[model samples]
Target: MQQSEVTESNDQAALDAEALQQEIAAAGAEEREAVFRAAVRAQAADVLDHTTIDDDSNFLEQGITSLKALELTRNLMSLTDVEIPLVAIIEHPTPRDLAAYINEAYAAERG
Candidate 1:
């Protein structure tokens, strides 16, 4: 990738991070999970360069390469300012599962 492309990607990632935070924060307790799942779906789609991804679709099965998994992990960490390991993608393997972990992290951050 060219320098300009890298910079653009970084800027877009920053914007996505901010949007993810806002989306989750705006949700009430009962809606938090749904909101988080949506955010996770968006992140996965962004990292995979897809327009949309099913919440329960296995990431690896969807062709998420190691590099894309790393990008997804970074995006999730940025979204919540939480430290998530790279293996999280393998363990969670789906937006729904990852959302649960991310929501837990967000709640912990609030505590």
Candidate 2:
């Protein structure tokens, strides 16, 4: 193959690798989010059983108080081995937001 063709092939390979990495990261994020949501549901089972918990639903509105949030954060930390600040639950009130935050923090810690 010509030198230019070889370079183009290398570039394509790099792009493919990058794309695959992104897809993997996205899949991992989705899985983490699912797990986080499950944990939240489990923790709030008493209150959530009668209500639907969507991604955007407010945890406070669902009866998750500050003390409950602390307990939930502790549970998450034990499950994920990531240190989540107490304020994180307040800042990222919903499971979706908290999951994203935890995933990002986990990735950063790994890096």
Candidate 2: 10-residue stretch with minimal lDDT: 42-51
- Using TM-score, give the best candidate's number: 1
Candidate 2 vs. true structure, TM-score: 0.61
Q: Which clashing pairs does model 2 show?
A: none
Per-residue lDDT tens digits for candidate 2, residues 18-82, read 65444435666667556656555554553445355676777788778777777777756755667
Off by over 4 Å in 2: 1-27, 46-52
TM-score of each: 0.77, 0.61
**Candidate 1, 1-111: lDDT as tens digits:** 999999999998788778867867888755787877887798899788889999899999889999999988887787767778898889999999988887777788888
Off by over 4 Å in 1: 1-16
